[model samples]
Target: MLARGQNVPTIEQAADFVERRRPEVATLLISRSVLLGSADNFLKSFPGGTLYAVKANPHPEVLACLGASEIAGFDVASIEEAESVRTVCSSKPLHYSHPVKATASIRDAYKIGIRHYVVDSEVELDKILACVSRPLSIAVRLKTPEKSGTYDFNTKFGLHPAESVPLIKRIIDAKVEWGLTFHVGSQCKHPKAFSAAIHVCHSVIENLGKMPGYLNVGGGFPVAYGQERSDLTAYFVEIKAACSRMPRVPLLCEPGRALVAESGTLVVQVIGRADDRVFLSDGVFGSFGEVNYSKIQMTPYHLTRASAVPSLAESEFRVFGPTCDSFDELDQRLLLPATIKEGDWLIFPMMGAYSNALASRFNGFRLPSVELID
Candidate 1:
């Protein structure tokens, strides 16, 4: 709603724009200050080189903002993300961080000037070797504890310390720069989880008898969501202490959610309501895709009434998305004013990470429009 090239100075102005326009489509308000501040804080707090994980939120504006920040570079999971980043900041460094990459993607990333690649197994390394020859740095993915974070990634990627020694040796045998990397998992709660993964990396380094060029503590930085919150400083302190024992090498990190989750606020309107179920303009198929899991809760919404109405007590409501599928409902219940009805707007904050990035254009529904705010 504000005219093109015009930006709202605050969330209140953004809400006012929504109220005036009353657009039925969901609108995402991105705070430029929050985005830049998050990047600045992470860069200052993190021990070494920082690479924004492009997979978290690759919105053009998001990429543009981080590209302008002090971030050292970006870690892209696929050729598409690499291309997207290149389009924004052609000179910024790019790391092909995904453990498993398609043959063509490896070739494409190499062509895109990406020299660093991560692998969990020798086969993936071979794939990279077959695609690109020299002037490369390979990071072996070390498997960390599965229960360390809300979402476990050990089952999908990463190699055990015992299994990683030989693989790292092969990376060294190739005469290319070798390093160790591990993900504690996404939305990691326990700061010690990072320390545990670092310990595993140190063990692998000792077993190989070779100092890695760098130690990549892949992103799992937590953010406050619902009642789940942890001090970001605690994570940094734990990581710095653990790395103190390891061989001195450049430290690297790929932070996704921790860098961008708090910069976004999603405003959706109520379309329909039943006894206790309320349908929203957007749902799991849209920006709320992550809400299908009970663990992911977007609560404490600010209601913007379409018309003046008396306030009412809050009550739990089953939230549903604007999709034909029966499974397009959120597993978590939201507490809204009992007088909540159709045409009311519910604004949910801290949604800048995977919301629109994970949305699908199912049933001809478009993704939420993005509005940048200062």
Candidate 2:
């Protein structure tokens, strides 16, 4: 990985370069080793074709690193996402996994070679039928009992198991290939969530009196943050065990956060400190949106003083963004050294997921400059 202009071959060098420059904007540090390793882990262990969820982090470098691995396709929520993935990894299959889609996106996705689509209702199936003349594959998305996950994904999407049975029949009757899929939720903490969700899908299929061509256990894979640790393999084991009770079919998984979260870091400078609040260059609408949107707890930001002596007196303080808006602040408090001054750098690791994808260019604070490190 390479930093902007200082030939930073290591994270150490990158930190030193940033300290010397004292730039007003924030920096996103990308570790190619970590990114590639995460992709390799999913490709080697997941036991089936894996699709990188494009909405997680679609940066060119991020996509390029994963593209070089064994990932087979991309889980795209929109035609625009498919187009972005196409620009970098053009040959890979595209799965339009968003249960609901615009008819125009359906026709365009077909023209762009996306053969796999997911639907949660009959209206979506009709939309797909109206747009595509060629053979297509549909995956019926069933809403599973969500007991884990940081985000409430089911609030806006997902279909009830009872509702999915009729939808599955509609797809089969339409003469198109079909499958079953579910999302346990994002950043899921419970291992049993996958198994429970799979059970819901199976029961729906049993009601329909048939099994699908494939079973897509949707992406909600978790990542460790701060002191929280999880046995990721246990999730796969539980999912496999649960599937044993259902008719055998080709299995697939889509992992977003677990695949890329630990691969990047956000480097921000403390612009100011007022009482117990510390203001940073990037805030809720910037690279730190995950902290605001999902209440994701970050590992305490690491202080890098470079050649200077570190402070001994540390305390917890509220962290705020550089934006003028009052709502542009982190939901949690951060503990840092009392000596942390305006020019000091605070590094936030595990920031690759949803950071780039959700950042807004509001208030003229564009997304941080991404610097890749080897």
Candidate 3:
């Protein structure tokens, strides 16, 4: 049987919950202990202050959990996100990390006591300058090499390191505290990717002839998904070794997926099956946005039959969402037991990061309700 109010319920308990409740709609089970464990991993792995990227999983419970952890603050893209974080934990520092911003957002963020902002161009810097007269802590994002991440963040936002020299100088001249920052990209599996970006920042600092207030490596810290377990220690070791040559300065990181991805699970029921195609209660439009839109690999999943019987036989099957659109099918096929049928449950792990945060109510399918199992 499932144990409610427990901090670390076993997988058997979760399977039992799915078999007993038989929820018609999808269910999201969250574990506070797992969230804390991820937070602790991040706090111990990085050699600098950490900021949770609010865009990854901005659930109120997630925000509150990290707010209470050793995390320094949050990295928000819009004023709404800043306001949301403020509501949960008012005192945590907020950084406007998005490169482009509306003048109104800048003004509202400033009003809400957000002093840190990221800019990649003079136009954005001008916008920030026009919005506030007070000294601001600014991070100039440098366009660096895209070494090895699932998503490339360099194309849309960052300035060439050479071009950032003048911008940083201008920020310093504006009597604002300045810093250098870059994103290695999302799900960065390579440890040297960070070292490479830091090298570029080092060059930029060298050109400036003086160290800035801080060097934010930005968030690309990876977490294990599917069959691979990433070594967080390797990434940390590489970053520490690379930064050894740089001038002594404060360091910061904005970890979104790594801090919250392992804390949640998505439970969906098999609604229908045709030949080798199986339809689920939730799809790309709902909790599987990353799988379709971002092309991120599916999280690890297991099966739980409603009858509580186990199957050892296995076969490959195509998965689809309940949406009317034919494109709702998952990009990759899943291997499941040949006995898998309608009413059986599919429990996906490591879904705490971007699953529900990006869900949409398409086809009149509501987002999954979150249940704290721990």
Candidate 4:
């Protein structure tokens, strides 16, 4: 029988066990512990509202959990994502939150009953008006200044606050349904960034002299990659403070990585060991670059038998993937238990979010199969 308790085997032991049992599991475990924890945190922190960003990880299981929790909605970029959410959850509101606008995509999203969307410019507003025939609600993405040490969303989308207020005015003037939304960017470590943006939202609302409909704070919740993460409560406090000033407008948050990143793990077997490095069966092109792009750190563990305790002492080792490209290096200097050896298994945590959604099968690498664990 498989290990049935909470005390599971280390990566090295798991690899040895798999060698005897299910050798085909190239990437085996994606634990629910991290996922549930992250999702629960988001729900608890943002009592105002929460919308799981579908771009993070579109796994049906993840979506099911959010739906069960009565999450506000989904932040989707494409019609396929909209359909995925529809398949998993009942008729919940869907936000076509991608800042950019394509006519065909707009038509499809409108067809699928996506009333909420993000518009940063008048041109996108025009495209949406042309494509969407029915009375639809929209969100104007406000381009706020990027705080220090965070990814900037202003470059791609969102209008200047001054311009946004007028744009909201124009939408109202045109008798079009619309709301106000702002994204501070992704992997935001600063809680004040949201507070600052919320203050801006207040100004915009006051300037518009109407509540509009919804005030989307946009998703920038950070996940613990390598370093210690900030408290979600602090960020929520800022949001609450801002929202309290304008209580009538509904609040929405689009959290992608924080919802599913920690919930999943990537398990790979060591296929080759030579020199000071060990090459795994999976590569960065396979399912690890999501965190890498954000420069997030990862923890690797060795799994083995119950009696065979993998040494906890750490040593520097270059862990590479099966890809031939030089950039395929997963970790330049990963410190793992000294007992890690050939044919061992390595497990990476906080991989449930962006990895699978953004993974590319480059160099003919096969995507890892996902296994959900309770």
TM-score for each candidate, following the candidate numbering: 0.93, 0.92, 0.94, 0.89
Better of 1 and 3 by TM-score: 3
Full-model lDDT for every candidate = 0.83, 0.79, 0.84, 0.73
User: Which has the higher lDDT value, candidate number 2 or candidate number 3?
Assistant: 3
Could you give the candidate ranking by lDDT, starting with the highest? 3, 1, 2, 4
lDDT winner = 3
CA shift at 107, candidate 2, in angstroms? Answer: 1.1
Model 4 vs truth, CA RMSD: 3.9
List runs of model 2 lying over 4 Å from the truth: 1-14, 17-21, 228-230, 301-309
Q: Indicate whether candidate 2 or candidate 4 has the larger TM-score.
A: 2
lDDT score at residue 211, model 1, on the 0-100 scale: 94
Off by over 4 Å in 4: 1-25, 32-34, 226-230, 245-248, 304-308
Clashing pairs in 3: none
Sliding window of 10 residues with minimal summed lDDT for model 2? 1-10
1-374 per-residue lDDT for model 4 (tens digits) = 11221123333334444555543335635555556666776787685678889988887877877777757778898889989988989667888988786889998888788888788888888898778865778788887766533678777777778888777887887677778888888888788888788778788877777877778888888765644543578788877876777647777888887777656667777777776787888767777675456776666656553323457676888878788988888545787766666666666655677777767787877788876655
Sort the predicted structures by TM-score, highest score first: 3, 1, 2, 4
Off by over 4 Å in 3: 1-10, 293-305
lDDT of 1 by residue, 112-155 (tens): 79999999988998898889979999999988955778788998
User: Mind giving the per-residue lDDT tens digits that candidate 2 earns over 190-229?
Assistant: 8899889888877887787887899999888887665443
lDDT-superior candidate, 1 or 4: 1
